[model samples]
Target: MTWGVVAIAGVLGLATPLLVRPLLRRYGVADDPNERSSHRERTLRGGGVAPLLAIGVGYLLVLALGNTAAVGTVLLLAGAAVAAGLLGLAEDVRGLPVMVRASLQLVIGIGAAAGLCIAFGQQWWAAALGALLIAAYINIANFMDGLNGISGLHGLLSGMVYGALGAFSGSAWLTATGIVVAVAFASFLPWNLTRPGLFLGDVGSYVLGASLASLAVASAMSGISLVTALAPLAIYLADTLVTLARRAARGEPVLRPHRTHAYQRLTDTGLSHVQASLTVSVFSLGAAIVGVLIPLAGLNQWAGAAVIVAIAVVYLLLPRLRGSRLPRKPQTALVDIDRPAAIAPRVDFYPKRWIVLGASGFVGSAVADHLVAAGHDVVRLTAPRLALMPETAANPISVERALNSDDFDALVRAFEGSDVVINAAGRATPDSPADADLYGANALLPAFVARAASSAGVARAIHLSSAAVQGRRSTLDESLDTSPFSPYSHSKALGERLFLSFGSPDGETDHVVIRATSVQGPGRATTESFRHIARSFVASVAAPGNQPTVVSSIDGLVDFVTRVGGSSGPLGPIMLQPWEGHSAYDVLSAAGGSPRILPRWICTMVLVVVRGLGRVIPEVAGAGRRLELMWLGQDQRSEYTLEFPAMPNHVLVGILSNREDAS
Candidate 1:
């Protein structure tokens, strides 16, 4: 199809903001940045009305071209999405309660499903799952609207995916829908940026999300599992699920109001809205590309599932990858008969003068041990001892206080005379009603410490930050700018800045911020992502062929943290995977189990392309994933590799065997 649809739609996308901007003031439909909302200014709330307008206009334009049937389908779905979006619109115009909005969403979802392309004939399972996915996505999309251009950009990329995958002939309806969505997204984007006129009101987001979810369902019906079809959206999915589960467990209204999603965290981490949006877009787009190819590569369903399983594992692991999960089974004591003269071990490792923030955590403990073993005196700092350590501290110091202003003095006192400092502190809080104290301690607090370090002329600092700071749900590397999608990430950047600014000659300090993929090793892990992977890996292996909520790969990249007093090795530069690039199953395989998300053959294809990419375009990533974003009409495989670095044949066989046995 001609690019006109996307081009025109993009232009019109801006119109919504312009038109709605005036209406917002007239109707008093605007959001005030305060305890529960994000924006600082009183901006228009129903900007999503623009895409609805665009869709309507597209129909007028296309109907004259004898495309009435397609227009009817497009409008029906768009109308349903719009109806659903009204929930957000009502909330936008007048803050509605949660139960009210959600009840409306369920109604809209069911109604929209009835009017969907299933009328043309769809698999029964696809219809049901698609409806649920669509409805869920509507909220996901709406939830993503926390930052500027995020939800809009998601629409843009998903539109591109449809354009790439839907065949012009065989899937003309979808092709047309893609065109309409493209035009709508294009028109909507400008308004989101430069200046705001229209917001993709809940209506816009719902339509975008619901429609995309429907497409994913369609793909799943082609026999691809939800795990594979929805891979591109994994970042969002994983973050949303984690945030929801965390909130739900706490009895917080998970669906109500909270900017705790990973994307929200990235935005908070200090990246601009654009940076955060692009960061997420990059990975999601790449994932969508990789996901589409898995099943097409002649890898059987099981293999594809394995690859995807690996991906899900990585999503949770990358944040905890730097440290090893040295979870040793409590040293079991053997009978005295076998050990008549047990020798006492020598003093091998010393407590290094290294300080660890969030020391009580699993990875933090591992990191502390690593430094202490290097022979320097080490000090461990935890967020006040809510729960004291059971075992005696080798060199552990629990500094207790609210991470905010409360503990700054005590924290300062603890930092004195420390050589290397590693901040592994993090917290889970919604952005709106923020845990300012924790945000300060975990995110802003670092900056405060950095400022102190600057004053004292302290030299070395290594800030351990999550890959979530990169944003999106896909593969990423250093080339991409920092995109903090949530409050956590936003604060992370602030903290990192404190270190960098502290190190600057002007600021009087210098330090290095190591953005780890994820720190994994041992019990009591620092990150929920790693724990989730562990849990999911076990669950997936136990029930093979069933899709897990997440996916990544064994060949996925991981970062291991190793440092010294004034210097560190591998400091030059290396690739670190975002949430999407670190494979969970691969790491789990390090234990035992076949990955159920990504098949080995499919992964082999991607590995080949990644290697060839450096030689071809000199860009180290995404070339292959980029290819995956296009129309899935054509199915082909990349040449397979016999071997890949780190991923050995033995591990592959072991994982597969384990998977079968577990199943």
Candidate 2:
């Protein structure tokens, strides 16, 4: 059954990667990241072996079971795909000359065309067209494999169209081949969706294109409409033809590798590899859908032509229009965080290109603005789920990894050709209370950044660490030994160690770690704070809250980064905070809330009650624990030595003022 054939192919497709990845790596089959490469690091190549192998095995099973009129044509299709895939594999392993490659492709295409003509009892004219189209499609598929997920999705969608057409035309061979190809690609998608995953490579692309071409050619031989047969591949065909024409007009080297394709252009402008690939795949699917439905609907020739033209026009224009609209100014306010008098100003230094990680986060966004405002070339790295605000979308760099994982290779790519790499990404809140989350972000992430910065030959790497690493010390300084008391603090301490260690080996990478305290800004406010104390305990809480102390503002943080960046000073760890700290209650009350104060005994009674409730309610436990810290704040108060200019007496008002101005 067709279902059984597809299911078998899908299982093989999924399993083949696991079997072949090690072999490819062992055989030294690797693709080095180049100027035109979508990936940042050198990764294993020859991933196509898996899917090609799957398709071959599936073809044999289908051939054995199916006794149909198109069996000889199906045999021709399988032979063509195998021949093309082998040629591609030869090119991948050992360099093949252009002439040799072309001669081989032509041989395979012509052979397939002759066989199809004989098997279908068709004329010489059909054979000539089939040969040309098959060869062309083979190359087009190879060209489109530059980005991740493009080839896989294209094969899947195109296969669907072919299967539908075959069913309509009552060709069992076409239907079986299409189903097998679609299922194989669907199974292989996960391995190609993210960075550090396998690519289809030349071999896989050749197999896909050849298989699809064979289906189309065979369909035409069966008296199916040529227009319907080619409709599924319209987007790919159009892009390939247009790119070829443009290159020829400019007299460029057409056979050489280049990044001028529309999809590549979209990536260059701001789209990620996945984003660009998906755009083309969706448009192609839409066109394929029309191809299948319009004939069934019996639309007139003129109307069908109009529909096809409209789809082509829209697909060609969408990327260009989207690229042109990316905003230069960042949506988040950077000026609000820049206080001229708060920290040292920028000294005389050359403006350097910078790469910023986690640009969608509160601190990262401000850092990006600071770099851009200073007229430095900044490439902001964003995750899949996070979109760059149009205000700051001037230019973007694609990092294919998600935010949570330790995708260090993406960092290396982003860090390439940059003078400085700023890591403004990390977990700031403890609401989730997962040790894995804290350790992954605060500890492991900085280590990854350090390695990437080193690998990219970056001049400097700055990491924004937290003062929480020191726990509740009264005399906070850089030299004081860290005694982290919580998961967040522990992770921060470990991260600081890892970052600082990067400079110890060979001293090539200048690493700077800033331990910042109580960073507050418009969006920097956290949900992880003191809660659930009785009204009677308010008085005791108010005393510690009102203690004079320094606070770190978002503006002060940015000023420190810029000034430190400008200086030619030696890289080392620094603790930064405002010179004066407003009492915790004074800062809290200033935010337009009625102050509550309670006696010490009442506070103790509330803590006991809250602790009891915390057994059943974890949230209550967190609240009760925070209240205990507030009660013990005076004992833990510290005079931090390294300081920036004081924000102001009315800190909350000044913060609001700064926020309003940025808006």
Candidate 3:
């Protein structure tokens, strides 16, 4: 009789998804996408109903076997599944307000918890906390459901554990019901393959969550061991709990839709929903195996739980770890400064399909240099790129019609296979720049980039803006929430907004906007790389005297077209004042500490001498001899005063004037 009932339930349960799969797909019943949704595609879902069908079938079978300890509990589960499923279904279709839906969940979750406690002889407080636990568990499962087959896969594994453990511990009816449920999920596997025929709906996730929590309590009651049953679910639990605490502290709506989940982060980086979903499924199954074998392995129940918890603890930062870090102050610094909060994918032979906006300019030059060094293939996009001009402007050009040109088509073709798009180029020209560069280069470039990135399978889109967007400031930090003022700055802000708005065709690109400050480095070849041309001063000052000038700060320096870099064209961040000779700023910066009483006259005079020679011969600029002369003894002299003012450091002055004497 039990077998007959189990067979009927499994068949009926699995068949529901098969029946509704087509409708779900046709109607586009999917998890809605927002800033928080893990998935980009609106896949067919609402598949959780099948599991309830299995539970109902299993419950009838339990009843047929006579009212045993398992029969009563199985019936309770059937009731819980019915309630949770119905609630979740409503949320899916009608999009119930969170408070209302959560209220329903709270009641159902509480009832499920209370009934389980009654069966297990735990206190009401257990039921109360258990209600929270069940809610959190379902939340994790819901949170974990970004990828395809994950919920179903884990559900199947967890169900199998319950069945085996129940049978071994003399809970045959429970074991029988669990086996039927697991088989039901397995039976429906084919329909839910690729893109998911049906989603488990809130109903399925809730039922599974309630079932797992109930199973944990029952397992402890039946002597299967608490930790053993609990370990497999620990990773999911830790993620949900920590998020709850974090969101609550931040005062964001706890039930609000957001992609803060670790699983969602994994899905963000070009991972197919199935790949990420399977990764966790594999872990759950492994956890289940370890959990089941704990007693056999001579490990304590708690020890098994510890193993699961350990993995969970480490994954607390999974989402954060998945994306590459961005720069904190993107505007001020030049170059591809990575932020600690950002995470990047490291795929071997990772396709180098990324876009650089101002590939022909200073900032673009620097970014491309490092990106190439970092092993990325570069597709340089600029307005005049189509015209076959020698180079793109430092500002936006009449790149207006370029968007409609065949060149734009080629640009799009380049991004089709790319994984990321870095918008290093922007319009820096003021609104009046005769080149028609400002509006076209600054305003339209982003849209063009966005279109290119979205069309090309690009998942990560980074927009480079100017720290100037922060308003006239010498320095700015990441936390400041200021507004823009200039046409160039306004255009930058607008570009970011546009990409964020219409950036992706499928909304896969997690649009990232980084506003940089004075960008300077060897990476950016241009007039800008010369900002670090002053870094040569540091190296010169640091170098031992009489060193080769070729080895001086000027060796292998980054390059660029001065005419382009010097223009206030559309590229947002300016080159900053190119190194004119090291200022006091450069001197102290080279000293690497608070400035002491270095002779200013000596250093200035030395720089004057070397700079004069630099104009004649690049190799002579700030040779070690000049740096040595400056460092030795440049003190203020007041010979007319009765007190003998220090003219210079005698030992160091002697070294500068007489190389043999210094030696």
Q: Give all TM-scores, in the order shown.
A: 0.46, 0.49, 0.48
Task: State model 1's lDDT.
Answer: 0.51
**Model 1: CA > 4 A from native:** 1-8, 35-38, 59-64, 67-75, 95-97, 115-125, 196-198, 218-229, 250-253, 294-302, 305-663
Q: Candidate 3 local accuracy as lDDT?
A: 0.55
lDDT of 2 by residue, 1-663 (tens): 457778888899898888888887888887888876777877776777767877787777788886456568777888998898898888878869877998888888899998999988899999999999899899999988888889889888888788887778777777788877787787788888766788777888888888888888888787766677777788888887877666544433345576777777778778888888899898888777777765677656456556766787787777677763321211211111111111222335354788888888988899899889989899888622222222321111211132234356676777889887788888776433323455567666776787778888887778888776665566456543675544455556666765565433565666777766656667544411212122223524533345443344677667667655555533345444444455645544444334465565776787789766654444445456556545534222323334234445554445633435532
Best by TM-score: 2
The local lDDT score (0 to 100) that residue 198 gets in candidate 1 is: 46
- Candidate 3 residue lDDT tens string, 193-253: 6443556777778767766766665565446666776766866776666765665444333
Candidate 2: clashing residue pairs, number: 20
Stretches off by above 4 angstroms in model 3 are 1-6, 22-28, 31-40, 221-224, 243-255, 268-271, 294-297, 313-663
- Candidate 2 achieves a global lDDT of 0.68
The lDDT ranking, best first, is 2, 3, 1
Give the per-residue lDDT of model 1 (tens digit) for 1-663: 345555555566665566567777798776667755657676766777778667655545545555565655555556564566556667767777666776777676666555553555655655566667777877777777787878777777776666455552255556656567666876667777866444566667766776677656544543444555677566677667766666644433344575656566555556777887887787667666666565445445555556655655464444334332321211111111111121122233222467777776655666667666666577788744221111111111211132244455566677777655666666533232123454445445555465545544454556665454554334344422455533445445444444443343552233545555433322323323333544454322222222211222222211134432244222322223223222333444444434454453565476567645433322232233222211011111111111112223343233323343221
Report lDDT (Cα) of residue 309, candidate 1: 53
